[model samples]
Target: MNTNDSKLREQIAYFGRSMFERGLTAGSSGNISVRLDDGWLMTPTNCCLGNLDPADISRLTRSGVLVSGKAPSKEFFLHEAFLDRRPTDRAVVHLHSTYATAVSCLPDVDPRNVLPPLTPYSIMRFGKVALTPYHRPGDKRLGDEISIVAAEHRAVLLANHGPIVAAKDLESAVYAAEELEETAKLFLLLQGQRPRLLTPEQVAELERVFGEKEDDRAKTCC
Candidate 1:
């Protein structure tokens, strides 16, 4: 592998350890993947994020065939869906983070945008998180659902499952995922209470500024 590929592998491992140690993921309940010109580098199936082996990360071809190392995560469909649709996003992060998953379980959430506009950072980072209907883990069909919302949303909360964030790069995806979790925590905490959410105009301004900057980055990404 070349220098960039080696660096991505190390980065995936490094961030995986950080997320796992901080309880963003439990056991092997999360997955991460990075885009490569030829294919992808993904965390392997049944592997704990905290203990990733950079050398053992799976490398797949452009057509999704495994080229080397371990087998890709069963949620391979999820990663491939995001990277394929979000051309500018370099990484996809999916985590069974506690609070986010709890929010996903709530029956009253708006299916279109689950997280209330609680923080500008959340809105700037997530755009708006779509709430996808429940699908079994590792089920290929879930990718289809993701594809429908992939172009418009930077994140999706899988009903009864967890949250997935796609970002300009691996680190950004991780941070977005963290923000998602925190936002979820706040959402839950504010239940049955009056919390001053950001007004629609405030959210729109954030989208116009930070969100458009992201769009600009996408334009020059290639």
Candidate 2:
């Protein structure tokens, strides 16, 4: 492997293990992918994130052909949806993290923005997380839904499923995914007990200052 590819392989394994150990995802319940100059590197299907070996991570050509390593996750198009829509995004992380999945299953939460703005980090990292109506696992149409929303949002919650996050790089994607989960945990914890949420003005100010560009605020407003 080239030096850059070698480093990415190690990083992917490290973060995958960390996510597994911290219960961000349970056995074989999550997948991660990173865009490469040549193509992409993705976690294999039905493989425990905690047990990933760098050499076994699947590599794909720019045209989506498998080039090396194990088979790619069945949700390959989900990752592709985000990367194709957002050219700046270099990594995607999808996880069935406990609290976030719980939030997805809620009946009253706004599908337009699944998590409430309990903290600035969540807003900064995720913007507004769009919710895609539930689709059967391995459904290719799910990618179409994700592409529509991901064009304007960096993160999205799949109804009755989990959260998929895209970011500038793998570490940022991982951090944003963790932040989404923590915010979801807080959202559930404070349920029925009115928690002080960041006002719309506060959220707007955060987006103005920390968002990728001024136009991002306009494009991402729900």
Candidate 3:
């Protein structure tokens, strides 16, 4: 009911609508959450992103208690585990984007190189996307696996699932997730044909530039 909470509520609803409209998620499949000074603002469990009401969002305490009405998403562990791993994170977005999930199901896709350096924007946004193996939806083990690589990755592909990204704010988080899906699309488009990859020197340089800033940021996890 306060000013900041109201603002965040609107922001969540706005992004949730964008995700659905943009086809990043379908049905009731995706969940979103952003960190608040008090706790977090998460989409209500089973609520389709396209139809979410700002006031219907769930508010969870730092200790993972549900402080408001409506149950939290069943995959709450995915969000909470990232927060535990990285205190600097401000938001988390998980989407079952078409391209990203398709790439995930491919056995040839490499975890270390989940997304190629197809565009500088992708590189600048998400340095390297770690690919985590498949786990059933809402499985706590998914969070555990993500925690292991969260320290080094800004984005990750959930094998047979989709992609999850964490960032300093909701906008950036959503943007990164979008880029992940785009890169995956490009990867599949270029499959069966060798595509031009960024040279090691270029990748190294990007890492050097972005890596410094990322490294200084409280030793964050994904």
Candidate 4:
């Protein structure tokens, strides 16, 4: 591998292990991908994130041909949808994290924005998390749904599935996904009580100060 690819491989493995150890995902139920100049690097299908080998990461050409390492995750198209819709996003993380998936399975959550504005960090990192209706795992139609929502959202909840998040780099993506999980956990914990939420004015201010430029980029990319 070239120097950059070698470095990215190790990075993926390192973060994958962190996610597993922290219980963000378990039992091979998640995938991570990084967009590269030539193509992309992704976690192998059905491999435990806790024990990934840097050399076993999957490499795909820009045209989506697998050129090295293990088979790519079946959810590659889901990751592609985000990258395609957000040119600035260089990495994607999809995880069946516990609290986030619990939120996805809940009925009556706002489909357009599943996550409530419970924290400023969530708003700053995610803007709003669209919720896509359920599709069987590996369904191509899931990608179609994700592309439509991802055009306006950097993070989304897959109904009865989990959360998928994209960002400018792997670290940002990982942090955003972690934030999503934590916000979900908070939402569940405070379900019965009327917890204070960020007001619309506050949300708008955050969007204006932090999200406006990215929204413009998203529009241009779409």
Range of the 10 consecutive residues with the lowest summed lDDT in candidate 4: 213-222
Q: Model 2 segments beyond 4 Å from truth?
A: 213-222
TM-score of each: 0.95, 0.94, 0.92, 0.94
lDDT for position 71 in model 4:
96
lDDT accuracy of residue 21 in candidate 3: 98
Better model by TM-score: candidate 2 vs candidate 3: 2
- Put the candidates in TM-score order, highest first: 1, 4, 2, 3
For residues 91-172, what per-residue lDDT tens digits would candidate 1 score against the true structure?
9999999999999999977888888898877886676889898888878778998998999898999999999999988878
The CA lDDT of each predicted structure is 0.89, 0.89, 0.84, 0.91
Best by lDDT: 4
Q: State the number of backbone clashes in model 3.
A: 1
Model 1, residue pairs in steric clash: none
> What is the per-residue lDDT of model 2 for residues 4-102, given as tens digits with 9 covering 90 to 100?
887898999999999999999998999999999889999999999999999999999987789899999999999998899999889999999999899
Query: Number of clashes in model 4?
Result: 0
Model 1 global lDDT (CA atoms, 0 to 1): 0.89
lDDT of 4 by residue, 97-119 (tens): 99999999999989898878998
lDDT of 3 by residue, 45-137 (tens): 889999888888988887668888578888888988876777887899999999999988988767877777876667767778889988898
Sliding window of 10 residues with minimal summed lDDT for model 2: 213-222
